[model samples]
Target: MQQSIMSTLPLLLLLLFSSLFPAPSHAWGIHGHLIVCQIAQGRLSDAAAAAVRGLLPSYAGGNLSSLCSWADGVKLRYPWSAPLHYIDTPDHLCSYTYDRDCKDEDSFRGRCVAGAINNYTSQLLTYDATSPSTQYNLTQALLFLAHFVGDIHQPLHVGFTSDKGGNTIDVHWYTRKTVLHHVWDDNIIKTAENDYYGEGVAEFVDALMQNITGEWSQRVPGWEECSKNQTTCPDTYASESIAAACDWAYKDVTEDSLLEDAYFGSRLPVVNLRLAQGGVRLAATLNRIFS
Candidate 1:
């Protein structure tokens, strides 16, 4: 009886843990979003900066990073939004087309991150200089933009549809068991926190914001195009993420593989690039909206 009871404990514990953390966590973890916001906040135009400060709720105290995780915070309560953080593509094709692939699991449709970004950006545009600070859904728009931009940059968030965006394919980060989606969402950012900065997340974000002093420090308002063509700007980001997901995030990963030195060595650079781009684009978007 004692042995049998002990044998059931691990399963019981696992069930309890699952209940506590029922959903796939936020993309890029807390640190990734914070770093993105802090970097963007540092680059804001003075008018854009002041406007952002005016729009935030009193609790956030004009600090954008403070509300970086708002979407994840409200996810459980608003189940309809669960699918808004990512888009899924069929296995190995590595492309995104809105006409076919933009719908989520819900038949209601158009709930994917790409769609949400476009919708929310339009919503933000509805607010103008004469609009009262709290006159519209400005806070929601800013919060959604801050979070979704980071989501679109995370490769696995736009990953394969067949394997449930790498949620089903299991792997290990060194010795611990984890799934591919999570490894990108949280592990890489957490590892970066512990290894590179060796400090608290806020401190790390501050350090990152301080270092954005190159050519793009004073980022302009409407320059999010990573491609030459002016159109397709939104889908272009989704497509880029899909390519990264197929080529890199899932590279060398398998059900039996242990992700370690070779995996981190090559892939961490991509993570940093996405983070930087997310930050720059987010800042530029806000500047366009407010300035």
Candidate 2:
């Protein structure tokens, strides 16, 4: 009996650790979030920049990018926030509607990523409220807004519900095994950094910044436009993501499919475009909020 109990100790410890730190389902990895926030901080209006600086904690050193992944980090502490990272659209629909699909598994409306974006945008809008009773934590609102904006741009974040945004669809990214969702979340970005950017995220960000001003300059104004002059337009971002999920992410792929150079080369442009749009729109939303 003593020998058996001792043998089970390692198994019990493994279970405890696994329960404490479950695998993450974040939309974009840390590098992706950092890239988006860095781009956004550089484009902030003078007033917006000052407001951001004031809202950020001193430990952040006024660099919004440094804490862009704060929302993902706090998921274990804030379990209720897990559902706000993505919208699980109906299988094969290739479309998104706030009224139709923006809810959690429990059918709570306005509980999806788009809804989170709207909620945070509204909270941050009260930055200058004359009333002193504003209870909203504007700092948290900013971090969540920044993170969800990056989340909403990831195509798989608005993917088919059957696969839980591709989390269930196993695939091979080259020789390594991973899921479709993780492919979008981290693998593609990691490959880009290693192969093209010398394994440096800052270099990847600089390249995207140049494209924002050079290759993608003409179309950026359209990306920043919000219907009816809304402060932020997450629905548009979500819709684009679903479309891209169908056209690029879920297209011609299946369980155990091997994704290699063909997949990477075709999808990298879409990834780049989405990351750029997330950054630009985040900046635009902040500029509107603080103006």
Among these predicted structures, which one has the highest TM-score? Answer: 2
User: Each candidate: how many clashes?
Assistant: 0, 0
Query: Measured by TM-score, how close is model 1 to the native structure?
Result: 0.83
lDDT of 2 by residue, 59-139 (tens): 567788987877786676678899999999999989999999999999999999999999999999889633322478677
TM-score of 2: 0.91
Residue 234, candidate 2: how far off, in angstroms?
0.6
RMSD of each candidate? Answer: 10.3, 8.8
Q: List candidate 1 stretches off by more than 4 Å.
A: 1-23, 133-136, 202-212, 215-223, 226-232
Error of 1 at 66 (Å): 0.7
